[model samples]
Structures are given as structure tokens and as C-alpha cells.
Target: MAKAMRTTPLGGTRQLRRWHRARILQAIRAEAGISRLRLARKLDLSPSVVTEAVAELLAEGLLVEKPLPPTGQGRPSVALDLEGECHGVLAWEIDLDRMAVALLNLRGEVRARAVLPPAPDSLSAALEQLQAATAPHLSGVRVLAAGLSIPGLLEPAQGHLTLAPNLGWADLPLLERFRAALEALGLNKTLAVVENEANAAAYGLYALGSLALEHCVYLSLGVGVGSGVVVKRSVYHGARFHAGEVGHISLDPQGPPCRCGKRGCAEAFLSLRRWQEAPTLARLGEMAERLAQLSAVVLATLDPERVVLGGPLVEATGEALLRLIQAKLPRYALSVHAPEQVALSPLGREAALLGVGALAADFFMEQMAYEEVS
Candidate 1:
């Protein structure tokens, strides 16, 4: 399958060193205040390689040395952290009810954030207002890229939306509109990305420095039921870029109609509005049943190391829903092999925005490495 947001291949010995340098920087970000010895151990690299990478990062002003805590033995260790406030990225999320914009520092801390005044009637109007609200935060900030999360079908690399049923938009050239808005505000140097909201959320959780899972499934239950799958450190985008449209997975062939002109799709049953207005026992049972079935499918098909349930529904229900979903997984699975761990997203409502920010951060680091090699 053709991948989304493909990275270029490394060439020759020097380029490979640059790639290793980038990986070292990411390791430092993941384990802040980590010593070179632990970094080499964690990344499975030699001590000399870690030392060389640390030196290059120090020269590039991306790392800062920290005084090691007392070891009470041998030689004192040296710890390193991401340099403070070197740069930042802008991350935006457009949901059904509202839109959010956040400015994140290099270390993924939010420096500034704001919720836009609801979503505008048109994509153009929404982009204009979002840009205006975001301009003030951009003052004196070097924004390397802008990450956009859309709650619909998207061409990630190009920021094009083929359809956003909730937004009443189809075939919208979102990146073009976003770029024009940025240009109007003279923020032309900032790179822009458009991606599916669920996908962004999945990546955001994956980028959390604490969690060390290699494979994860992020189920987003908001206006619709969607999922993002991450294998290793990258998102798995099927050839058609519709890999994780789990919302469209039909639960019944004879139930209610779906936006995709299908009957008894998962989206129809899992609508957050339906659950909120009349959350009867029967409704809750059905929700749990569908979720278990979906989780089982995920495990049988992908066998993710863990499954993370996130988005508005989980935010509202907290661990209650997580417990329910966990309870139902074993009963509904088609096979005996099931993931032992399933939980709620630690990133909470900020997963999508933070995910896009993480995406931008990785892209910026990659670009920097390529430049160094050149």
C-alpha cells in the first residue's frame, strides 16, 4: 500500500549518521533528563554512538545538559534535555461542535491555546476566523508547521477533504484555504498539514513520551466512531487512505441508514447524541456490544499491543465506559488471542491537537537532519 506522509530514504554513511542523530534527539525528548548511558541502552546503540549524537545535538542547540543527581559512586553522570523554547508548532482541530487551536513548544507543552467561536457555516469562514484568532499567538514565535485535524475523510499529505458529513463539506481543498489564510496574515513560512481527526489522536497518544508500546489502536468516539492504527512509530495508511474508517464498519445489513448510503453501519449506532439524550440500560448494552465487537475485530485483524479509547464519549463517561468495553471484548472476540491491555487515552480531549503537533515536530526534526547532511 502507498503510504501517507512518506519519509525519504537515507543515502550513504553521512546521511545515515544524520538519521541516527535525529533518532537520538527523539530519544532525549522521550526520556527527559536521561543520561547518555541510559539513552544508549534504551536505543540499543553503542556508548560512542550516543556520545557522538549528543555532541551533534549540542552543537545544533537542540539539547541542553543537566547536572546529574548524586550517584554516590564512580564518575558522575550527565543528563540531557530538549533545549527550552527553541521553537514551537501550531496545532488545530476542527470538530463537529467546535474548533480548537493550540501552540505547543518543542517539548510538546502547551504555551498558548484557545477554542474558536464554534465552527463557522462554511469552511472558508471557519479558516478566516481561526487564522485571525491564531495570529496573536504567532507573534514573535517561530512556527515550523501547522497541524490540522479534521473530523472526516482527508488526503493527509495534501490537506484535502473528500467529505466531512457533519460539516456539510465535500471535496474541499482545505490546505489551499488554510494556506491562503496564513498568507493573508503573513505566516507564509509555516508548513501546513491536514489529517483525519482520529488518525491525529492516535498519533498523539503514540507520541506520548511515557507509553512505550510499538503497536496501538486509537478508537475515537465523538460525533462519529473512528479509529487510527499505529504500527511501530508510524501510522498505517492503506492504499486508499481509508484504512481506519472504522466508523463505516457495518454492524447490521438491515438496521438504520448511514451517510455512506449503507444500512446498519457502526456510526449510526454509536452516535454520541443518541447516548447522551436517552442513555437507557438497553442503549448502554447496545453500545457496549458494538464496542466489544469492534474491539474484537481490531484484535483479530491487527493484534495491536494495546487499544486506547478516546474522544468526547470517553471524556464524558471516564473509566465507566472503559470498564464496559473491557468487559465485553472477551465475549465478542472471534479468536482466543486478545490484547490484555485496553484503556482510556491519557491525552484526553487534547489528543488530536497534540498529535498533529507531534507530527509537525517530527517533520521539523527530519528536515533539520536532511539539511545537516546537505
Candidate 2:
């Protein structure tokens, strides 16, 4: 005779249920229009568990079921998708020359986006302009959180901009300012986050449909060159949150000086600002080769499954630069097999904003589960 299975507390069971629901919801967002049966197989949860969790999500208006045409199935398959217009996040990117604000849905799709003026003199000024610009599109929706991306090293935990040479900002308490602005705008309940622009863009590419690998590196080449490494489908911030400072990687001992006070750093040669200053075919090729060298270093160390080139420079050079990088990769890759393929980001300038949306969406989902279990 077998002993009876141990029973968990009623509250524990409800918590488990909420966790399962969160996972199912996440899968639905990742692979929009995924069937429950497929989600069960992918997430390795029992069909009954998925059914129960999905049912709850449907009731909560976070998910919707769409009927799929049968392909020799018993009943028409119902695919789960994030409910459009249910809720969204506010994502902002403050760069050297511009500030972009976007509203993204649960599936990381941009519902509305606005490119405001250049970086403002103060955080408050930027917030005021952003609020006025996005006011028309901000009504009738629950905003889960606000995410801000900046081109600088940041104390992310406190949302402080520690250093941004291009923008001439230092030790700016952006997160605190953002929270205060939200309170002033009567949006006190919305959470706020601040992150490095490159890291956010890398995470955005991973969370969005841009990359399909568990590990990939995103090279952001704007006023500077930085990298974001995604391991296990999450951004890998190093011990000091400077994991991918590829920009400062010294390339030439006697090369031009970088803002970080390094000579011959990759950013000194490959940055968009540098390219713009010396726009010539020869310079473009040199920059492209340097980019390839950076990619080689990434492959040699991190060995990610894919490498992505992004930021303002990539957009400017487009296919010409992409081909140069690809052509030069074989020489530097030093791999027995073909090197990891490098691709341009589909998210373009909006990558950071979408990335914040991805983070905010996940945070909001976890918040939902917490509220339910509590």
C-alpha cells in the first residue's frame, strides 16, 4: 500500500498557482498566439496546471484566447495572446541628442511613441516636456511602470546617473527625480527604473523578437561603444554592473585618447561621433574592421550564440557597414567552425525604450502575482 501524498497549506497552493500563472503569461508574451498545449510542453507544466493558470489570466483580462484553424486536430486549437490595450509601460531613452518616450503593451509592441527635443537641462524639464507630449496618448490605461534609459554608467539600484560624458551629467539622481515627477503628475503608484542604455538595448533585443538565442551580445555604437551581454535570456551585469564596457577596451596603445582616459580604446575609433568627424570611405572601413575586432573579442570571451550591432552608427552605415563587419569576422573569429552571425537590430533607435518596456512588463507581471498571493 502506498502512503498518501503530503498536502500543502491552502495559501501555499494559491501561491504556487499564481507562480504558474505568471510563467504561462510570460510564455504567451514571448511567443504570442501560443497554444496552451504548446505552452504546457514548452514550460514542462502539466496541462491541467496550465489550463487553470490560463483561465485565471483570461479572467484577469491579461490574456485572450484566439481560435486557430485546425490542422488535423480534434477541436480548433485556442492560442493564448497578451490582451492588447489591457495595460502598458512608459519607456524613455535620454541620449546625447534626443529623448524618446514610448508606450508599450504587454507584448512589447509600441502603441504610441514620441521623440521629444534634445536632452533637457534638468530631469524636471525633460519630464515636463515628456508629459505634455505624451498626454494625449496616456489616457484610459493602467501604466505598470516607467523605465528610463541613459547613455552612461549608472548606480541602477538607486537610479543614479553616475557618469555620462557625452551628456555632461554626473551623479544625477534621475530615479529620485522621476519618482518625484510622477508624484507631481498624480502617478504615484507607477514604479520607475533607470538603466544603462546599452544594457537596456541588449535586454530589449533579447526580450523582443530581435534575437532567438539564450546568449547574445549587443554592441551599442553611438557617441561611444558599449556592449550588453545576455546570458540565459537575461542581461548579465557584472559585479560592478559594468560587464560589457567594450568601449574602453584598449585597441591601440598610441591611438587617440578616449573620454574614459584610455588611449586607442575601441570607442575612440568606432564611435559614431568619431566617424561623423572624419567621414570618409577609408575611415568607414577602418571603423568596420575595428567593430569586427570587438565582435571577435566578444566571441572569444563570452562565446555568445549571436552578436548584434546597434545604435546610431549602425543605423547610419546600414548594409555597407554590416557587410564589412561580416567580411572581417572570419579572419578575427579564429574559430574552427563558422563564427557567430552578426545582425543589425530590428528595434533600431527604439531598442532601449522597448527594452525598458520588457523589463517593466515582467516586473508588472510579478507584481500581479505578488498581489494575488498576498
Candidate 3:
């Protein structure tokens, strides 16, 4: 006798539906031009569930389907991709020397970009410059949100920048100011997010799928040395949301003075200013050795898959410096960690801008999904 099989309905709760929608979008973004069947398989979701969620996304203009070429099969399939041309997020990186802005579409593509003059000394002047630089790009674009990456301690929860030594700014209400700037530009509905430049760069690398592993570290060497730690594809902000200040790690209590008012901190030894002053092989080797030492500490503590060296200094030095660091890392790191684990960033100076922009877009999409489900 044959046994009868029983099947349960695929109905899901609101939260589950929202999760499915978000996952579907993420999977599609990761593997752009993916087929619906492939998306369902990748996410381990029922075909009906994916179809329903995708239908909602399509109606909301968040996704689009492109027809695939005939393969001599029963029926041709359609590929899914983000509706990138219609929506975007504004991303900004405010450094001590300059500010860069970019418009990132839903597909994580930079549709437009511009580099503004150095940030002004006062907060009000900086805001005016930012508005002027950003307004020209937003004429016809639907901006979902904005992301700001600053080089210093950022209390994101409070929207405050506790300190930016290179810029000589402290206790600035960054988020409030940015929001006001957006409102003044007639974008009152857009959301804004602020993060440390190093953290944003790390997240940007993660979002770009540059590394296979979920955990990694980004060492940003610019006017100052900073590091961003990512664990499981998320930035690891410590108890006060100010983790990854690796620059302040006192390597030698009697070493050179750092801008952060600390002596012998890693930044004092490794800041780009110091390297630029003496761009010689011996100095490069010293910088690489010190960076390798710092990286070794990072590896032992976080045990990330790799430590990515980035920022203006690394871009200027290129692979020559990376080779030195790779050669020296093993001396301080554990036997299990290989020298090859240290690598150079491919994104260069644009890492923070792109990273924060992608984050802002993802946040907007997630919030939209939640609202629909709720």
C-alpha cells in the first residue's frame, strides 16, 4: 500500500514575511541578474513566498525583472535586479583635508561623484559647503537617505561627534546639523546616518563582497591612523560606540606625540604626515614594521580573516608597503595566521564614501520593508 503524503501551508507571519523580503532583496543585490528560481534556492524559501514578496517589491518600484535569452528550454526565465536608475542614497566622507560625495544607486553603483573643497573650520561653514556641493546632484534624483563618514569618535546613537583631532572639532551635533542641512535642501523626509571613517570603510569593504570571510579589519592611514573592525559583516562598535581607535593604542609610552594628545600612540608613529615627510625606503620599512606590529595585535585580539590596509597613505604607497607589512606580520602574529592575511584595499580613497552610502541605502530598504509588514 502507498502512504499518503501530507503538506502544510506556506503561510508566514508578518515578521517572517518582512525577513523574507529583506533577504530576497539582499540576495538579489549580491547576485545581480539572478533568476527568481535561483533567488528562492539561494535563500531556501518557497517559490510561492519569493514570488509574492517579489511581486510586492516590483509594485513598489524597488526591483525590476529583465528577460533572459532563450536557452531552447520549455520557458525562458527572467533576471532580477535593483531599480537603480530611480532611487539613490547620498554618501559623504568628511576628512581633515577634503570632503567627497557620491550618489549610490540601489544596485550599489556610484551614479555620480564630486570632491568638494576642504571642510571649513567652523561647523556652519562646513554645512553651507556641504549643501552647495550636494544640491546640484539632487535635482531629479530620489534620495532615500544620506550617510556621513567622519574621522574621529562618533556617538551615532546621540548623533554627536565627540572629537575629531585632525579637524579640531568636538562635541558637534553632527546628525542634527546634517538633518537641518537636508531639510534646508527640501529633503525633510530623507534619513541620515553618521559613522567613523574607518568603520565606514570596513563596512564598505564588507558590503562590496571584497572578502570571502565575514570578519576582517580595516586599517585606515591618513592624517591619522585608525582601524575599523568588522565581525560577521557588521562594524563592531564597542560599549560607547567608539571601538576601533587602534591609532591610540600606546605602542611606546615615550614615543612621538600624537594629535590625540597621547605620547607614543600608534598614530604618532604611523600617521600619513610622518610618512610623507620622509618618503624613503627606510621610513617606509619602519612604517610597515610598525603597522605590522599593530596588525599583529589586531589579529591576536580579533582573529579576523584579514587586515586590510587602506586610506590616502596606503593608496600613495601602493603594494610596495603592503609587501613589507605582509613580510613582517608573521613575526608578531600567531603561527596559525599567515602573512598573506594582510592585504591592500582595492577601493582606495573612495572606500568610506561608498561604504556609508551602501549602508544608508540598505537601512532605507530595510525600514521600508518593515513599515510595509507592520
> Which has the greatest lDDT?
3
Q: In model 2, what lDDT does residue 124 have?
A: 67
lDDT of each: 0.78, 0.79, 0.83
Off by over 4 Å in 3: 1-17, 369-374
TM-score of each: 0.86, 0.88, 0.91
What shift in Å separates residue 360 of candidate 1 from its native position after superposition?
1.0
lDDT of 2: 0.79
Which sections of candidate 1 miss by over 4 Å? 1-21, 35-61, 69-78, 338-340, 370-374
TM-score of 1: 0.86
Candidate structures ordered by TM-score, highest first: 3, 2, 1
Which scores higher on TM-score, 1 or 2? 2
Clashing pairs in 3: none
Pick out the ten consecutive residues of candidate 3 with the lowest summed lDDT: 1-10
Residue-level lDDT tens digits of model 1 in 1-374: 11222254457777767766777777777678999999888877799988998898898777889779777987789989987565678888788767898889777899899887657778888887778778888777778777788888878777788888888889988888877877787878777777788888788776763566568889999788889988877878778788888888888899899878999888888878878987777777788788887788788789887778888877777776767777788887755655356778889888888988888787776665564455
